[model samples]
Target: MKEPSPRRLPTGVAAAAGVLLIIPVLALLIVPLYAKKGPQLWGFPFFYWYQFLWVFLASGFTYSAYVLIERARRGERR
Candidate 1:
């Protein structure tokens, strides 16, 4: 028996998934937004901590996007 091909997401879902993944990268690229020092977390400056926090958030967003796309692809297949 031949194996079936993997399903693909619709254009809109794919676009949204791309946006979700790209947003964090773009946010990281724009350094000025988080570049600051007034705020501190246990001696960590705003700039340092903000980026560190995003490391977690970015992973979440990426995973969420992956799920979203997968769901969409599955729905289309069904």
Candidate 2:
């Protein structure tokens, strides 16, 4: 009897998930983009508020990526 080969995510799904995961990392890694003191939000500077905003944005991105990967895996199982 032969063993079954491991399934791989489709190229498009993989790429999309990868990009979704990378967006937050890239956004926070580049410092100068949000390194500013103006545009205060409820007394928080742009720099502070910007990072705080990403906390939620990153969560959403991560969840979205996870869902995409899960769906792909489920589809492959069928």
Candidate 3:
């Protein structure tokens, strides 16, 4: 029988990935930050459009973080 080995992250890479992953969570978590009505984008209120936009931003950030962490993990194994 064999046990799976442990994995480690490079210095600062984990924190960077964590920060990237948290961006969307923090953005939506803060209500007052985007809870507003003003400046419209193609008839869309700032509040409405801002949150909608974060959808893409969140995905991008998530994917980026995933790539970063995965890359570091691959490097750690070598």
Candidate 4:
């Protein structure tokens, strides 16, 4: 008997997932974009709050990508 082949996500879905994952990484890497002290939120400096916000944003992006990839895989399997 032959073994079942692994399911692969569609090219577009895989590219979209890759882009989603890269967004947070690229955002954090560009330090000058958030290295400021004004526009405080709840007494937190812009620098502090900006990075903190990305934590949630990154989680959301990651989750979205995961769901997209999973959906594509499921579709391919069927």
Candidate lDDT scores, in order, read 0.89, 0.96, 0.91, 0.94
Any runs in candidate 2 off by more than 4 Å, and if so which? 1-5
Candidate 3 lDDT at 56 equals 99
lDDT of 2 by residue, 30-74 (tens): 999999998999999999999999999999999999999999999
Query: Where does candidate 3 have its weakest 10-residue lDDT segment?
Result: 2-11
In candidate 1, which residue ranges exceed 4 Å CA deviation?
A: 2-7
Sequence-dependent TM-score of model 4? 0.92
In model 4, which regions exceed 4 Å deviation? none
For each candidate, give its TM-score against the true structure: 0.85, 0.89, 0.86, 0.92
- lDDT for model 2 comes to 0.96
Summarize candidate 4's per-residue lDDT along 3-76 as a digit string, tens digits: 88877667899899999999999999999999999899999999999999999999999999999998888877
Which of the predicted structures, 3 or 4, would earn the higher TM-score when compared with the native? 4
lDDT of 3: 0.91
Evaluation by lDDT, superior candidate among 3 and 4 = 4
* 28 Cα displacement, candidate 2 (Å): 0.4
**Scored by Cα lDDT, where does model 4 land?**
0.94
Worst 10 residues of 1 by lDDT: 2-11
lDDT of 3 by residue, 5-52 (tens): 777777699899999999999999998998888888999998999999
Candidate 4 shows a clash count of: 0
